[model samples]
Target chain A: MLKQYSFEKTAVQTFPDNVSLAMRTENLQVFYGANHAMHDADLGFPKNQITALIGASGSGKSTYLRSLNRMNDNIATVTGKIWYHGVDINEPNVNIYEIRRHIGMVFQRPNPFAKSIRENIVYALKANGIKGKAELEERVETSLKGAALWDEVKDSLDKSALALSGGQQQRLCIARSIAMEPDVLLLDEPCSALDPISTVKVEETLLELQKKYSIIIVTHNMQQAARVSSQCAFFHLGHVMEYTPTATMFSNPQIPVTQDYISGSFG
Target chain B: MEQTNFQLKKQDAQSHEWDARLHRATRATRKDWIGRGISYLCIGVIILVVASMLWFITSKGIATFTQNHVSLWKFLSGTNWAPDQGNIGALPMIVGSFAVTFAAAIVATPFAVGTAIFMTEISPNKGRKVLQPVIELLVGIPSVVYGFIGLAVVVPFMRHLVGGSGFGIISATFVLFVMVLPTITTMTVDSLRAVPRHYKEASLALGATRWQTVSRVILRSATPGILTAVIFGMARAFGEALAVQMVIGNAAIMPKNLISPASTLTSQLTTGIGDTIDGTLPNNALWSLALILLLMSLFFNALVRFIAKRGQLKNGR
Candidate 1:
């Protein structure tokens, strides 16, 4: 099975000099006890843009995305400089609780809290010391509308979120995240558990959100990456194999591994 | 034509033989029937035993009210409890039981819930491994031993501190607190552990601190279980006999204060049952007191079941 394919190990590509980045990583590495789960990787997310991380399972795309928000602190030993607003969030003294407020996330499965839909949206707002009833109600509507779920759920805002279908629950998760008005929204296969119709709806919501928030998504569906993202990064063996425009990456991949992976030779 | 008729006859005979064998095999075997019969008999025996116990207790408990012509309302509301002079009022004992149990619950709930939270959430892995078994070991200690310790240490200490005879509601409450702490803590830990990890993760992702997540989400989700734990502890305190009797000073009178001597239902039954003759009014009155204690226990169990059922309904399970 060893073909005469030359695999190049080059530095990950960066955005152009003039493009301002919303968040980026510098030499990010993750370790689970002794096993080096993710190698040192550097990547940039441009402001107000959609970037999709595409990789096979265990290729560390999800790991890389999770590390950006410091979600891996309790589980793994992550060492690297996560640069946002001229501060390294990887420092031990940094308050991860405060940092997470600015960088929201949605997990793969739809994990809406076992609370009412409106309470789910207002939970973080209340925790952040916003108590005005008028302000909470206004923000709840805007967030749900932003996620494109206001029409279906506006009538039942007080109903338990678990009563919603899987797709609605996923959209509600997106709504819950955006309710905090974060600068960066990280989604890890947010549509993997959804049907095609729900997938398309969530993709549209992400596209609409890109006007106000920089979105970084890790998706298994290659067509979803080509459909929605402006920039795409192909990860292989815990490293970014190639970073390019979504159209070019789909149509004419420069790396042999990327071409083989996209063409379904080996995923 | 002759060969085809013979073959058909042979096939029909063979099929009939096979059907006969199948019918015989499908019928219940002697062993199976015997086992089923034994199972039904065992169930019947259990029902009979429970019914007999209930009938006996009910018959004996109602004799004082019906045969002895004692006024049920006065027996419940009257303050005095002298059995010899025809005064069988149980108000003091009922109030004493409730007061001691309530005080014990108030004293124990916070500590037990805190210990449960520490064991399940905040403590390190090794510490939890060590602490959980140690707490479970506390439950294995005998109630009499706990009572003896309370009598020797807690009662004397309270007498010195509060300036009254040490046998009272406070001393009994302190003993019951120690007795129920392990039970409530164990149950609370189990319920807290039952909460899905995703709930905590979602809260943490929203920038909430661990404490906030535990209090708002985890505890809220586990409210039924925590309530069940508290009720179980309260039930145990309510029914406890030896330890409470030892520390409570067993004086059948209306408790004046935390330090004044009092008597619970169990304490009165234990202390008075020995002196009265069988089938007498005094004995029957004690039996009625026992029936009340039984009813209280049943009520607590029903409340626990109701809370659990409501929790299930809310969860839509």
Candidate 2:
């Protein structure tokens, strides 16, 4: 057994990069067909900082990320209140779309719309009601640059997005979310499928992106969280074992499970 | 080493001799030949049947069409449909087919797409499992039963609604739309289901609601397959006779309104040929009209196939 970090012990501590809460999950639980997959979890994400949710398979890290935008509302029976900027978005009157528009998500796999590369970025903008071509073009360029994919794809924006490499597609997806100008970005294992080189590119993109948007990333890679994130939340068996600064979580993890997971002894 | 090489060549020669000996013993038997012969003969029979039907219709229809020096303009423009007076203007029947098919598609397409989206995206796991099989059962119901229901129930209701001239294109179309709904729904569901789940997730992750994801991403991605389903439903409606024949008024005059009594090209051919002489020009005209229906359906199918192929290629790249 490992010592658990309680909310009382950690809640009062302020992050080095002092920023307001972009999102905070309270007692989130999820079930699928009578099978409980995620138990009660509470965590707060600081604005303009990368918060990494690290866990083994089935630790409910992905579930926690999904609940940030109520993305699990479609296929699962989810119970929780996720607070965003002082408002509880789980209330019936709170519009999920408006909530999500402020909190964009990038999935594990790169799923570009079966459309042109240019249209991929423009789709989010248009769906949010941007109709002017000139403004859209400018946003597209700005987002591509932010994702670190502008130079490779700027000449072929009109081509189908499926033609791009895997790394490029993932970056394009990031660019798409950025184009929406969301205040927070949730990434679900965004680099699990990429090669090491591609993973490095993605981590670099995340490092640069944290300057503008608060990010909560779900990852199985311990070193990745160590490298890019400022805060780390280590989850084990649906319970959050520890929540601390990345350096402290890596070097002085309070839980044996988190230690075993980080040392590659057992998942 | 040279002596070993010679031994390897000698062994190869011995194996070659054994292979030839086995081949001679395994010669094909009479039964094998008979089976092959029957397979070829069956294929020939299928081809013959299809060709004979085509020839029978074309040989007779071409003569009638040419002998009448058929001004397609007069045939299309003339509204008179009464054959008792020796005037066979088919404009009424053509117009009737269009009205019925259009009305049916208009009502059925939206329902099909909506049900498909629900099945593929919205329903709970249990609800999806239960609803899918129940929806599939709709397609198994016979068209004749549909006709009987329309005749016994729908016509009278329309009679109350329109007050007179109840069994017309509108009533027939209502029944046809319901009948086609199952096919369209199933096929549309298949197409929507085929869209990768990631697309839906991607859209929703962007903060698009379920409806927005369905309308903008899932539906757009599944457009080609859905178009194929609609085209198929339209073809089925165009060729539908059992239900339409019972509900349609069978009046051989032009319909001035949708609720007015009318006849379609198929209804005329079926009832008209039964009362006419076997080899008369009117009988030949039936073949000509049937040929026209065939051409129209073929054109529609080809158009759909072209679009579907283009979509597949685009997706493939």
Candidate 3:
């Protein structure tokens, strides 16, 4: 119904050898029972940086993000090589649970476990066999501080996480993932359900987190991509259309679809 | 003033039309009233029947203690229940009823939880296609058929295994366990399905295995609902009469062992009601048993409501 863009002329870039990559995909494609939801999405996330995947509704950015930790295991058929920490983690025999421990995910909705704030952070830690009281308490504090939530929630660690405000819940989710001390954090529109103030707070937390964890965030908000990301990848109709520096993609988009989308003329 | 009067005249005409429309008995409105009136009449009839039954049972049950001069504590605490020979103690039947119901619930709960987990979390599509109708058919089965099967198969099996009359507490418990299994399983499946999808997703994304996720988060969130299901199954088991009567030997004595013949409130009431005179103590004692059954059902319902309210409070909503 709208003007269609050619997928053949995508402006994806290849970083030089000196730029260290935390994770990379080689021709990653996704299929939901023959629907081919994502196609040939080969992208790289740099170490200790935030890369935002921006796109419209039905774009494959979220699909691609979910494939990194194999979260789409039963939901869709993803085919390609997902290289993480010098291993092809996409293989079926690879322990996805272990993969996820090193590379964590945060969902669009703020889905904190129906637990207390301390328990929400310590649940996965305990499951991973961290059973000491002092270590658990320390990880809870440090992860909460890492997500910038410690100052507000320090006094009430026993309170139910659901009792927190929406912003605080989202931040707690970030802390829960960071508590695992993941090398890469994949967020699928983590702030889309949040209010403006919450969104700004999440953005600030993300910027602060980039120094430790490699973050790949899929968002529908263009300004969020510009503000929080150093690298930007624009997706359209299951294709990766443009990948560039965040400033360059905002100022001079390499393709018509990316330009029209960010300028709000996308029909 | 003239302009306002002209506007007022127009408004008066509009109001007259509005009044006519308001009073008009449109066909749709008449149809609505007829439907509502029929439903209300049905509910009224049910309410009247239930209220009258309650009144009749209460009066007749109270007659045993008041008109026949039996003390409340003796009726509740005494064990000998020879109603004809004036030894009417209802404690044996009370204990029998509770024993069978609790035994059945405890045996069936683990099986129900396992099946419900399979239906909801493990293989949902296959469970829906295969197990759904199977459970529905189980619910639709007549209690008499279940009783018959218990009499033929389970009774003989118990006789061979334990070397007794085959009709005892264990046989009735086996029958009731089968009967209440489907009820608990279906309700448990519903509650498990009601758990939010995001809880499972969040747990899995945090690198927890499926077992850990289901046990820690999904099952934790659904605990109240699953408890309600178990309680509902227990209520059904407690109230089921004819099936339990057929398998449980109607001997009104204190049960000493699992294999011994015992009498529940329902079994004793059914066995003795037809043979007793209207004003006699035996008939009145049967009525008293019915009252206890009614009160126990009400207690179970209250317990379910309490659990649900507590669950909501814990969820912080």
Q: Which stretches of candidate 2 lie over 4 Å from their true place?
A: A1-21, A77-81, A90-93, A132-134, A248-255, B1-45, B66-86, B122-137, B313-317
The candidate maximizing TM-score is 3
lDDT of 2 by residue, A140-173 (tens): 9999999999999999999999999888899999
TM-score (all chains, Cα) for each model: 0.95, 0.85, 0.97
**Clash-forming residue pairs, model 3:** none
Using TM-score as the yardstick, the better of models 1 and 2 is: 1
Clashing pairs in 1: none
- If ranked by lDDT, best first, what sequence of candidates would result? 3, 1, 2
- Give the alpha carbon lDDT tens digit for every residue of A1-267 in model 1: 533444355435788879999998988999888888788778889999999999889888998888888889778889889999889988999998888899999999999888899999999899889999999999999999999999999999999999998889999998999999999999999999999999999999999999999999999999999999999998887778888888889998878888888999963
Q: For every candidate structure, what is the RMSD over all alpha carbons to the true structure, in angstroms?
A: 2.3, 4.4, 1.7
List clash counts for every candidate, in order. Answer: 0, 0, 0
Model 2 clash pairs are none
Residues B49-101, model 2: lDDT tens digits: 98998888778766555765556666666787654554667788888887888
lDDT over C-alpha atoms for residue B154 of model 3: 89
lDDT tens digits, residues A1-267, model 3? 678788888899878989999999998999999899999988988999999999988988899999999999999999999998789998999999999999999999999987899999999999899999999999999999999999999999999999999999999999999999999999999999999999999999999999999999999888899999999999999999999999999999898888998998887
